[model samples]
Target: MENKEVIEPEILKQVAKILKVPVQAIKNFSEEAAVNIISNTFSDESVAYTEYYKYTINPFEKWVDAMDKNEQLFKELLKSEREKIELPEKLLNEKKGNK
Candidate 1:
C-alpha cells in the first residue's frame, strides 16, 4: 500500500462544510489540489484581505477611544458630586449664621 497522509474523517467533513463542498471531494483531491487549497486558505495576503481582519487590524483603537470618553464622563460626574457636597455645606453654614 502507498503511504498517504491520513486526515480524520470528521476534520475532512468540517473542512468540506467550511469550503461548502462534499467530503468526498476532499478525499479525492490530488496533492497539488490539496496544496492549492492550503495556499488559498492562508496566503500571505489573506490576513490583509480577510473581512474579519479588516475590523480587527486596530481592535484596541476603539477600546481606547471608548475609555477616553468614559474618563471624560467620569470627570464630569466627579465635578457634579463635588457641587452636590458643597450645596449641603453651604446650606448648613447659612443656618449657623442665622443662629
Candidate 2:
C-alpha cells in the first residue's frame, strides 16, 4: 500500500521472514540486537555453505583443465602476433634489398 501504516507492517513481516525471525522480534530492531543476530548467524561454519559446493566433483582438476585451455589459446595468439610482426619485417627487408 502507498500509506506507511499498511506498508510498514508488511515490510516488517517480509524482513522477519528473510531473517527467519518473528515480526514481533523485528518491530523494534535495536543496534545491539542486530549485532547479536549477525554474530550468531556468522559464528556457524555453514551460514550460506550450500550442498552444491559440498557435493561438487574435483574443483581443482576442473580449474587446471580450464587453465590449460587458456594457455593453449594464448600460445596460438602469440604465434599469430609473431607472424604478423615478422610479415612486416620481411616486407621491409625485401624493399631494402630491391632498392
Candidate 3:
C-alpha cells in the first residue's frame, strides 16, 4: 500500500481549536497518541450516550441479542447469495488486455 500524506499542520491547528487544546500539543503528539486524543475528544458525547443507553435504556444489547439469535440464518443467506459483483468497464479496463 502507498503511504500518502493525510494531515497538514493547518488542519491540525483547526482540530486543536475544536478540541480546545494547544496546537503545539497536537503537533508534538505521536501518531498513536494523536489518534487516541482525537477519538476521545470528539467522541466524549457519543461515549456518554452509549453509556446512558447501555445502563438506562439498554436497547443496543437487546438488538445484539436478537441478531445473535438469528446468526445462522444470516450466515446461510450470505453464503447462498455469494456472486461476483461487476466492476465498471472503466475500472475493469484500466489495464490493457482485460476483456
> Per-prediction RMSD in angstroms?
6.7, 8.2, 18.8
- How accurate locally, in lDDT, is each candidate? 0.82, 0.83, 0.71
lDDT digits (tens) for residues 19-76 of candidate 3: 9999988667698886887798775654445544656657999899889979978887
Candidate 2: clashing pairs of residues: none
| Alpha-carbon TM-score of each model against the true structure | 0.42, 0.44, 0.25
Highest TM-score, which number? 2
The lDDT of model 2 is 0.83
Residue 60 accuracy (lDDT) in model 3: 91
Q: What's the distance in Å from true for residue 2, model 2?
A: 56
User: Candidate 1, residue 20: CA error in Å?
Assistant: 42
Q: Each model's number of backbone clashes?
A: 0, 0, 0
The parts of candidate 3 lying over 4 Å away from their true place are: 1-6, 31-99
TM-score of 3: 0.25
How far does residue 59 in candidate 2 sit from its true spot (Å)? 0.6
| Top-scoring candidate (lDDT) | 2
Ranking by TM-score: 2, 1, 3
lDDT of 1 by residue, 24-49 (tens): 88777699987887788775655345
